[model samples]
Target: MDRRLFIKLLSQSALVSYGLLACPYLGWAKSAFDYALEGQELIQQKNFAEAIKALKESTRIDPNSDWSYGLLGRAHLGLGQKAEAVAAFREAVRLNPLDTYSRMMIEIVTQKPLPKLEKKKKPVSPLEQEAYSEEALMKSELKAEEGLEYQVKRVVIDAGHGGFDSGAVGKSGLKEKDVTLDLSLKLHEKLKADGKVKSFLTRTGDYYVPLSDRTATANQHQADLLISVHINANENKTPHGSETYFCSEKASSSEAEKVAALENSVIKFDEPYKKKAGYIDIEEILLKFEQQLYWNESGKFATTFQERFKKWLPLKSRGVHSANFYVLRMAKMPSILLETGFISNANDEEMLKKPAFREKIVNAIARGLA
Candidate 1:
């Protein structure tokens, strides 16, 4: 049966079905507004699939309603149904040419390259010329503001543990510090060769650099992103996947907290976090407020990075996590810690030892950063 027919039948049944629609007049029937309102609430609750159902009913009832179509578009976008989102947004714009939200969303969702304006054959009249500069200015401003495009041009690559810090060690005697440095160097080369962005390293050789210094270097370089590379280890040596971590006040999971603790243990060699000193430093206070924004962006970036890496990396992707990583905590920009693989696991250890696998890891990280 057709979906519309199914909806119509469902709507009829909904007349007798309690709490199905937020309709008026004894709840016997629902207007487009009522259905749209239900969709809106469902969307607010982040139940995009159900919201789509209600939004579709609203559009069916009032095909010309711009608000219904706009809500429908939002529902589609929430579910990452991009093509459907664009279609609904276009319909909303078609129904009401002044729907700024839907109009901007269309460009944002599509991300189509801006067409270069062709040079005119003849100069326009003085009146047209007088308006041209201002129009061009507004057009550029609109694209930048409404486009919501984010770019990362400068990245700080941190090779976790140096000098005395050997980091995690495998049964085969592979040190996390050595593997990280090698990977970081390869990643630096890859990023530099790509010429897509500038990559800076916190440590260039076998020397101990404090965790705080790493974040400081990233800030001093004015990096757009900071990525600390490390290998993971577990006592049981069973886990063998890679994970990405972003800084947060609280870990996303127990495993995340443990991972953070393991990496943060290096702080013992560095000047450890002294118990809240007598005077709460103003810098610390400011960081508390500002870091939330950076942390959220970093979390989003970690997710994106994991998705990109999962496609090409041979190691199983353990996904992104939120942890209190000291190296990432003080970053003035978005930061992440990449647990490339489990050095404790035999298979992962052997893979890390291979030059080809290291190259693959470098490429994966480079693509993820891009």
Candidate 2:
């Protein structure tokens, strides 16, 4: 038999095994499957609106198909309908917990807007109420600090990509991994010299560290903060600026989501994180609430750090945004990721290649942390 025919037969057998062929709604299942395939093809062609329509039909025909829902989310995301994308992705994950792509999509979509509201004055859930209470406590602590004393005592600096991972490369031959590592080292030295707080580095030399391990290092040291250093890149090469980011369930903007996606693309190279047992139990629920509180604090700290760093940065300040970063997710302490400059731009690349420029960046970061 031909390879295509064999594959088709195998797929049909699998569908039958799943009882898709024997169901009372077999016609609907077949229709949904056809529409889903069409939608995927359309998405590949960048015809997102048409793809969305097909995917919507697929979902309506077979609401339980997690694959169709995940495709629908991608279609919505391509059209910049973040709220719709998040909802579709959330349903996909709920129907199939092992759908890592859908889970990542939910994180990316929710990093900005904190999920969409169904109606005006929606009733708050118990989890939301607890998160709000913790947020209030955090605010009170901040308000009580009338003095200019440092809020963070110990910090772990993480250089984004290294070793075989050269990260984004510039036309001028500058590598993101090299720049981040150098910048991180300089910042660590400056912070240590200040003597106000202790400092540590996730990577002191050129090498790769898994994203999860980076946060594990911070947690092990019981650091007060984690600052991840990275360089931005763009296909258009027009965007050039420094942006600080805090981890959030929803992205604050489409641009922030794109950045998160770019950074997260590296996850394919890392080992899969083994989830702890009893993930859906009470302990996990409480841990999620605590993480939310940490995220709230991280947002505040990111804003302050951006404000101070912008004053000294020679490049444009894109300001602070929030997104779900894998490197920041597991951290117990407040964490932020900084995109120092766009390596894709010629002007920014030239500046980034200079030792003096990196030193200036280090000084700005040190002052911001202070």
Candidate 3:
């Protein structure tokens, strides 16, 4: 199908998914239809440059529409336009915070390695709202002595795997991709509601992404911090607990090999044409390790996370370890991978389904980062 038609179909799909098709009061239907048609036509012609214009016009016609931004972002992504694609995806989320696809795209495209956004006091939901106690105030003052010089402005929170790629499956049938996405969304909501830190997610849907692309997203956004969340599994099932990993300047041969293997596995799915041998090489990845500054600042951030995890979470803190995971290796700033818990563990699996439990996990994460 032509780009215009494809976009039109996508817009229709988005509307249907949103259950807003029968709304007579909102003139969104006609406006969405028009934009989708023109946007798809331009996109199909490989006219991404012009497609953005038409797609944006669609959004202007219907200010509350997310379809326009989504279609426009797709066009930009196809055209190798990172900046515009980032903006478009961001707009999609702003229009509909629950639009998982948009949220994921924003996380993938705009997350940067720099620490620019600092935490600010913002409004929170009734459930999350609470005044800082005198004791808490005293502690904050004391904690400032050890506070890292950099401030957190924007954070990139990655929900590992999605859509076609379910990283691991639990006995209860909960997909790793789905669980991470759920937790990431909860974290995003908490951060936004708290009005303390701006946050972004890497994948908001059930789609597969290149591992390299995930790290690139964080670098692009210049994120103050990057937290890639995942559930752990093992053949033994005996090992069940939460573990956090930070980047290591000196990854042992075995550790580096494992990191390369895990990240490389995803590359094959994205690049099937390369020989199987292509996945075995770690030399290239090791060369890229120096890109992340490991001297002082990153270490402090990692340490802070480890300290907070023990203070808050119920799970046993496996303590922070260094690894050569592709996601952590590519971040230009402080980054960590959080293995929330072993999904394979029967006990952990049950707790994963509860909303309150998930919120508690989110709180711990926020507090850890704070």
Candidate No. with top TM-score: 2
Q: How many residue pairs clash in each candidate at the backbone level?
A: 2, 9, 22
At residue 331, give the lDDT of candidate 2.
92
Residue-wise lDDT of candidate 3 within 183-222, one digit each (tens)?
9998999999998889987877778877777877887787
Could you give the C-alpha RMSD of every candidate to the true structure, in order shown? Answer: 20.3, 19.5, 18.2
Candidate 1 Cα errors over 4 Å, as ranges:
1-149, 272-280
**What is the C-alpha local distance difference test score of each model?**
0.82, 0.81, 0.68
The TM-scores of all predictions, comma-separated, are 0.60, 0.60, 0.54
- Which portions of model 3 miss their true places by more than 4 Å? 1-150, 249-264, 271-296
Which has the better TM-score: candidate 2, or candidate 3? 2
What is the RMSD of candidate 3? 18.2
Model 1, residue 70: distance off in Å is 35
Ranking 1 against 3 by lDDT, winner: 1
Error of 3 at 368 (Å): 1.0
Q: Order the candidate numbers by lDDT, best to worst.
A: 1, 2, 3
- Candidate 2 residue pairs in backbone clash: 110-249, 110-250, 110-251, 111-249, 111-250, 111-251, 112-250, 112-251, 112-252
